[model samples]
Target chain A: MEQRRKERIDRGVKVRSDSIYALMSWRELSYLTVPRLLLIIGMLILPLVVTSMYWQRVISIVCIYALLALSFDFLAHYTGLVSLGGAFFIGVGGYLTAIFNTTFGLPPLVSIPLATVFGAIICTVLLLPCLPLRGVYFAIVTLMYPLVFARIIEAMDILGGTDGIMGIDSFSNRWIEQYLVIIVVLLLLFGLRRLVNLDLGLIFRAVKDNDQAVRASGMSITNYKALAVLIASGMGCLGGACIVHIYMWTGLSLFALDFSILPIAATVIGGAGTLVGPVLGCLILVPISELLREFGTLRIVFYSIILVGFIVFRSEGIMVYGQRKYHQFERWIKV
Target chain B: MNKEPILQVRDVTKAFGGILALNRVSFDLYEGDILGIIGPNGSGKTTLVNSITGFIKLTSGKVMFRGKDITGRPAHKIADMGITRTFQIMRPYYSMLAYKNLVIPLFSPRAKRTGGWRGGGKLGDRDTVSIDILEEIGFERDSYVPYKLASTLPTGYLKRLELARCLALKPEMILCDEVFSGLSMSEIASMIPLIERLQMSGITLIMIEHRLRELFKVANRVMVLNFGEKLIEGLPEEVIADARVKEAYFGSEEAKEVMDHA
Candidate 1:
């Protein structure tokens, strides 16, 4: 009897590129660089390439969602903290940047950074109590934070309340705004890529694998978790700050669940662990969202269909699927 | 060997709502002794390991490690004090390579301070040290077995990886929760020498095992637990001879038949 089985093997170039031998050949080097280059170059030119003024604005919006998705992916996949606080972080950063620009008279440039840093610190401090809570508990607390902030703002009738903080500054020009966000996203995407390979990243991953075993290894899981939250929240807040400036306003809407929900959807469609996947997902999803605007409320139905289709069909996500195709080839071989 | 016991458990009790998972269990483990704990399913064997290693809180009890009361201390604190454990359901870092799994424990403060696995007062080159530990625990270095992902490894290798992780900490005492449960006869045969070698290195071990034949070979003393209570504690032969332990393990009818044959 004859039997055969399908086997998957890494491409010769991929194998070579995985090692020091990659430097010896331009083919191997290019194999390593091309996908990354495509991402960077593709993102860099997207603002100029999109001719429509409305769609250009959508690019900036996509970048903002990408940042949120990146943060969500990092915390959920790497740190095992399934956080739904994207809205909470965005709300904090948006409001803080608004106050800095509107009340303190800080420039858009200065306020964004200030809001990002302080908002992150605030988010981390607030989330500290819930750091010990694992899995869904951490998620529920995070989900509640934005709602609580929203209600508090609505109830207290403070910080412009329902009307929101208006007359806030936009970036000096469209180019600066577009490039600023796109560059920041690229830098963070690459920076985080490096970070997850570092010793601290090792600790984060270990904490995720089994906190009990990590504890058994004598490292405090709580400390590593706090550090991961700080990093993730910082990224989300940066996005929030940028969005506030882009919109020229900050308000209760900053705490909207769209910020929370969309990034997670982006993460799922793009791939959960791969930081770039979520960004790619936002690029695909946000534009489709904008395009679907003509359908009015029915856009949500189209949105759900697309999401459900992706979940059911290509659930491993586009990046993972793409990576596998790029790196390995499969063929039937005799057993 | 009249030295003071290194680990002392006094009247340890754990309850889940109205049910007592562990009822007033107390035992002393001395330096360089292999203590085997045997029981049938849900006999509180694993629960005892959990309580001592600080994996769970004790309802009312004292766990003293070398005269220091370590009761209710966090698991990390207990591990830092040189008491490490391996899970019965091996919890290897699935995404990491086999050697990388040990690197985490090797990076621990305790490993750095105490020096890991014959580290000779210097914890040097963690990657190399981790590979060395993996090789020592039967991972074939030449074949790149240590370089393979932990998730891909078979049960035999995963079991060894579990022990390798504990050794990376240079632990004074290791609470092994069923290290032999899933292994074959030849694998357990090979594991016996590794157990003896670990003992020879002066590290104490508390093994919870169902394989009584293999366990009796290594354990200096045996304790039997029945329904969350200590049924008996004695030498392996003495424990085997006890009618109560047989009944607890094999049930009354089967135990009587075995006893009658004996």
Candidate 2:
């Protein structure tokens, strides 16, 4: 009996454009550039494109979640740091922005940037002791931070206690607020993409592959891990700082587990390692979440169903699947 | 061919909770020597390599590499000092391509300071240099095998990859763990020349093996280990001829079976 199987290979255009000589033909150049240019253009025009004030605010929230997912992707896929500290980063950044604005009488513009840098330093130094750990130990420590911080703030009542800080200044106006975050997210997404292609990225990947081997190569893995954590925490903090201004309030609610769990779900649904995949995942997820808000509390049940379907059927996630489809072609061949 | 001794292990002892793995083992490896370590299963041949290369912390002893006491230095630190080892079970960066697997070691600081596997495979042109090293170590030049994922390579290439990884460091001494055990006779035969070339190029070696016949062919001197103690160290002929080596390692009946095949 004769048998047949589907053979897959890279498309001619994909192979041609992926090389250094992509400039040789206009078609090959576009084949490579079009998809990326589309993502940039689509994101740039999104606020203007959405038209509804309600959904436009949703767009801002989507970007916030996208930033969080990007942090998760960069650390988990590139450096092998599985961080559950998304809420911790947001909480720290939010409170810092709140303190800077309320305590120092700083405006939104100065406060946000200050919070991002200072919050990342606070997170990095705190997490430095756990740098030697990997896998579940690291995950547990990161997960513990937000919960512990939330309880401490609630119990001690230092930074406004349960009621939290209020009257944090909003961005000067709505347009400034929306575009400010959209542009920063795009800048960070591309910046991280470029950074991962550098020599430092090579060491980060090597540490992920084998920490002992990376050490054998005469590198200090702790320094690289710390650097990666700092970058990721900064991204998460930026999102958190933006959130405080968007809501005009900063509270213990910033440390909610939704911020922790949702970004990971977006990363898994978008694609684990690809920097842009989580952003795309956030774009799809946040809207679906807003629509499912009609179902009230049952939105979680529906959300879990969608997440489970994505995990069970296409566990590689949408971006990996999408990238594979774009680059390769399959055909049935007789053996 | 005698040169200065490059490494010295003195009174090294390792206890794993209760069991003794290496019992006051002492040896010195001169430059340009191929030292074969042979023993039955669980005689601690691999443990000796691990201890000397700093993969495991020593309970007691000194590992003097190039006149410096380097006992309990981390594995990477040892590799940085130009001592590297290949795993018995093989630990290639399974996610990377076969040639790319060479890139990590080639990018290592030691590999950068000293040249990597000759013929100009340095930092700037690493991808090409890695393939050059791979081709030299028996991976077919310009074939899909070198470009293929390390996980997909056949056992022969994987074994050669283990050596290629060590060679990327341009290591002063390489601790090779059972490189020929899983190979076919012809595969082992082809690997011998590559081993000879590495030795000829001035890399010292400590080879751990169960395939005694193939190992005895290249090893200048052989050390027999029995239950974590050095039973004898001599030329391959003397070590192979010793009666106690037969009883302790090969056993009376298994020694006769080894002879029947020879």
Candidate 3:
């Protein structure tokens, strides 16, 4: 009996340029650099290309979700810390920005950065006791934080209560609003790309692989885990700060469960581990959700169908599949 | 055997709830000696290794390594102090490539201080060092084997990779848990020479084996456990000839097999 199998191999240029000698040729260098540049340029032009005020705002929202998804990917995939705390981080940052803008009389630029930093510190400290546990224990605690915060604020009528903080500062202009997030996304995406290849990233990945072995290597897993949490929360809070500035108001809606759930769904649809895939997933998803706005509440049903379809057919996620295709070519070989 | 024991287990006991898995066991392992721990199933051989290496806390006991009490230290701390062990069930990182599995331990503080497997001066290129360790443990350095994901490797290679992982720490002692199990006759033959080579290179070894014949040949002393208590302890010949050992192992088919091997 004759048999054949599909074999995948890296392309000649990809394999040959596996090392840095690719610098010798413009073709090899461009092969490596073009895709990255295209993404950055495409994102920069997206708002202007759309020309609709509503959709331009959608681009900003997509970038915001992308930031949250990036934080989720870095935490769950790299450190084995599956945080359902996106809303917790978002709420904390949003509230802080609201407080800074209103009470402290800070401008949008200063307040957002202050909110990001202080909010991360607050999140980290509150999350410290839970750091020792992973998996569902961590997830439950994180998922509870937003609900807890919402309940506290509602009952006490603190931080503007259900009415929320009205008249928060807005971005100076729409251009700054769009480009600020767009530029930060590109920086963070590339920064994380580089970070994962560094020594610290290797340790983060090792923590995911076998934390017991990492411990055996004579390092503290708890400390590394804390660092990972800090980095992830910082990203999430930055997104939250951006949201407060864009909306020019803050309320209990900032603590909405959608803020928590959507980033995770985006991560799964785009790809779990690839930092950029979650961003791509958010870009695809938020737009679809907005388009399905015509269907009203049925938007959720269509969304679930798309999510379930992705999980059922391509559970490895789009980026993993796309990455394999881009880096390697497949051919049938006789066995 | 070299004088002054490298490791001493003084009345080590471990109990899980109401079950006493290790009942006040004691032994001494000198530098440059091979100790074989053998027993029937459920005799706590692996538990002893775990307790000593601090994978599990001892219910009551003391473990001394190089004359210092290391009873309750964590596994990694014990490993960092130059004592390393292979899992009875292999725990190689499945997602990583075979050689890449060594990257973490190769970059360990112990590896840096001790100069890793070859005991060189400066820690050279990690990838090259990883491939070199893999090659010494039966991997072909230039072949595609080292590049293969660890999960793809057969049991024999995985066992060798487990040993390779310990070697990456430049361990002074290697606690092997059934390393010879699930291997072909030829594979075991090749592996015997590797074990001898590691001992010759000045690392002490403790092997827990159900494969008594081969184990008895290399082990200078043998300790037998039955129902988590020491049954007999002596030279391998004396242990094999003991009436108590035969009687304790009576119902088990492994008894007749070991007698035939003897």
Instruction: Indicate the worst ten consecutive residues by lDDT in candidate 1 chain A.
Output: A197-206
**Considering every candidate listed, which one attains the maximal DockQ?**
1
lDDT of 2 by residue, A1-335 (tens): 89999999999988788788899999999998898899999999988888989998999999999999999999999999999999999999999999999999999999999999999999999999999989889999999999999999999998999999998899998889999999999999999999887656767777888776666555568888999999999999999999999999999999999898899999989988999989999999999999999999999999999999999998999999999999999999999
- lDDT by residue for model 2 over B105-173, one digit each (tens)? 777777787668774534557788788889899988877999998889989999899898888887888
TM-score of each: 0.92, 0.93, 0.91
TM-score of chain B of each: 0.96, 0.95, 0.96
Clashing pairs in 1: none
Segments in model 2 whose C-alpha atoms lie over 4 Å from true places:
A1-9, A104-107, A197-199, A330-335, B1-4, B119-122, B256-262
Query: Tens digit of lDDT per residue, candidate 1, span B104-139?
Result: 898889999977988986998888998899889988
Collision count for each candidate, in order? 0, 1, 1
Considering chain A alone, what is the TM-score of candidate 1? Answer: 0.98
Question: For residues A111-150, what per-residue lDDT tens digits would candidate 3 score against the true structure?
Answer: 9899899988899888888987888888898999999999
* lDDT tens digits, residue span A1-335, model 1: 99999999989888788978889988989999999999999999998898888888999999999999999999999999999999999999999999999999999999999999999999999999999998999999999999999999999999998999999999999999999999999999999989998767888999998788899898888888999999999999999999999999888998999999999999999987999899999999999998899999999999999999999999999999999999899999999
Return the TM-score for candidate 3, rounded to 2 decimals: 0.91
Q: TM-score winner between 2 and 3, please give it.
A: 2
DockQ of 1: 0.65
Model 1 misplacement above 4 A: A1-7, A50-53, A132-137, A330-335, B241-262
Higher TM-score: candidate 1 or 3? 1
